[model samples]
Target: MWRCALPPLPRYPTVDELGARAAALVARHPRDARLRRVGTSRAGTPLWLLSVGHGSRQALVVAGPHANEPVGGATVLRLAERALADPRLCEGADATWNLLLCLDPDGARRNEAWLSGPYTLGNYFRHFFRPGFLEQPEWLPEGADGATLPETRALLDLQDELRPFLQCSLHGVDVGGAFLELTRELPGIAQRVARTANRLGIPRELGPYDTLYWPTLGPAVYRIPPPRRGDLAAAITEAAVESTWFHPHPYGTVTAVVEAPMWGVAAVEDPTPPADADAALRTVSHTLRDDTRLLEEILARVRPLLGCSPDVARLLAPVDDYLLVGPGLADSWDPDLRQGGTRPLPPLTVARLTALRLAGRRVALRTAGLLHQLVTASGHDPRGVLPELDRLIDEWCADYRDGCGARWIPVARQVEYQARVVLAVFDLAERDARVRSRSGETGWGSPAAVPMHRE
Candidate 1:
């Protein structure tokens, strides 16, 4: 087995640094690996694709298309290293696989500083605020002039050229527990994937946890709704049609955008865990393998079912609501912490509530902490928590509408906002309980804590 020396974990890396690291890795393992500069970012950073493996005809294309979600980038890098060292992983596969590690170097680099340091819940919270272009790297194929971004253009070019059987776009979510999204229907794969997670002691949940779980593509192949229009899921289906020019392949390409929760992968605790790189690596390895197996199973079962005649557009639809929201809350609760300064109350409130429920803080203390966070961070009045939360939500929506300049802001914001709102609610509940206890009205036991939604 060829084991490359593991680089020490840093909080983050600059865009240039990330590019250098990627280039070096490609250079060091050139025998089975080749690096291609697919395109340049809006910021003019070169987006590179690293490919490793012998020619097997069938290809598995995985890209960490988002900037904030670096776990996919890490996972891809690890996979590349593993593929170079272990011939079996590539050998056993029936088809050739070309994995595109990161498609958004500019966005990826904007948040690189956070990746280099010791992993922390606070660090994760802080990393999300850095603003990149409005267009998601993954969705850029549709483009700026309604055309793809440079990165997306590169992927599209490769997709047109290689016409691989499977494409897995790597992404990470903050709130949901871990789950898999499939392009085509795979009857028994979700259970198997869940089982793998359970075996690895990774937290797993099924069904849409929040709005983020909703469909970005067409209909739900594995879950619900047949399919829809627009988004990556839709775009990939469109791309598949052009596959005819590239090859006379028997099966149409099965493209999946896999989203794994960052917290689950890193095993982030409510109170937070001490940094442990080995444990983090183990978690990632298990997750990648579990996901890979699930994908392989789905491909094996569905390849025969895919046909060009009656286009399986519905087969490529999203199964869950992509918006992440709580029962009674809007989705714009938290401030994008990457902008620095004290982030508003929503995320802090949620953190306190989660800490109290999961980390075993006393209700009174949790409530007090919630109040403290709100008062200190958001400059909101402690006495009017509900009104403050409501106002914050309204302000956030207005800001989002103004900033996005689009009809609809991305649904992931809902999940982000909901997490913040729920945290605040939990914190407030804890605080209320404390007040009730002091006044001697013991009516309710405690608020039932709900798990963050994931699809």
Candidate 2:
């Protein structure tokens, strides 16, 4: 067992760095703890799962399921520490805690530049990476058993073996504020989460993104509509072909997707509806529509350039294709307005729109950069189009960052919020129809405050 080395706790660690830390902890407590190779990432990085506590009812908490969303790595590790220190954290409900530090190591390696950081907005946006829609874990495959990506298959295999009663996917954004996605709601879960998140200094997402399209049970909590057949493909292609092979994990398991922004923008937390709430929301819709239109315009310029270079087309066209797809929020929310009086744009609507647009542009810009490389590598000489596209993308990125002046969401807060939510949700499930989640409590200490041993 290697001792913890190379850095202090609470820092954003590389996939290897994090793996070492987890291994070191298991090394410390050999009886109740052991580390196992669940699977390997596409890039051939070993996927590690640290199991602490021996219980019948299983809970699997996955962090960095997506390569770019590594913020949860620390959160999952912290939870493992707590469980190890005080086994009671996993004592009830026969819950054996299996913490998967990150399932997507290949993409995570791409994000390592910003993982350990000054945690600045500029660094994050510059090094930002997210797997393409079809490449993600939960959303990647049509069914549970057959998965193209080794990472997905590994996770699906673990679930088959453990059939976790609860699954928590920890994810964070480079911009915007915190939000929660519930596959199914457990009573009293929302209030407990909101209170804990607030106490830990993380604000709920006030942006229109989650609120605009998804239904919220309470502040910042959105019920993610599970995908049916073809919904995954439809996400990319506007066309709906029946996805007969698709189905999310069955109803018995409860899952929570914790999405918190790396930098907490206080403005996003404000509940005061902007004075022109109605117009503000319409503007938000307009921004997405306009951005999508611009994305298509940019893609058109580059698509013709890729024809002869199937190498380039194979490598770069799908990225351009994704950008060509419309941002669906505009259409998804149109019905809400039809039933309404203009409610104030949720406090973070504009900021959310700004961040969302920025994320889209960043991906497009990366697409442009890769296209430029493909052009040069393919030996396509005299044409100057790719360079022009690169310059255009860089200019847009600079302008967007400068205009927003976004703050970095502190790493501590990000971890604590996620840790609390995972524990809270698991505790709720343990009660399993026992203790009713009561209202009226707006601050710290829920049934989740199971005595966790701290190091």
Q: Largest lDDT belongs to which candidate?
A: 2
Model 1, runs deviating above 4 Å: 1-18, 58-60, 130-134, 140-145, 209-251, 265-455
CA error at residue 373 for candidate 1, angstroms = 18
Off by over 4 Å in 2: 1-10, 207-211, 230-251, 277-318, 327-405, 433-455
For candidate 2, the lDDT comes to 0.63
Positional deviation of residue 348's Cα in model 1 after best superposition, in angstroms: 26
lDDT for every model?
0.40, 0.63
> How would you encode candidate 2's per-residue C-alpha lDDT over 1-455 as one tens digit per residue?
22222233566778887888888887878888879999987667999998999876677888887677887888878888778666567674556889988888887886787777867544554555555666666554445545577887887677656656577888886556677777667778778877987797775665534345556677677776655455542554321221111222342456677787776555555665346545654655555566556556655665676666544544454465455454554543333444456343333444455444444444455555445555556566455665565565566556545655556666777777778788888887666523322332211112232222212
Tens-digit per-residue lDDT, 37-153, candidate 1? 777777787666777776544354454465666655555555566556655445644334466656766656646646665454333333332222234544443232355456656
User: How accurate locally is residue 200 in candidate 2, as Cα lDDT from 0 to 100?
Assistant: 77
After aligning candidate 1 to the native by TM-score, how far in Å is the CA of 266 from where it should be?
A: 14
- What is the lDDT for 399 in model 1? 29
lDDT of 2 at 147: 56
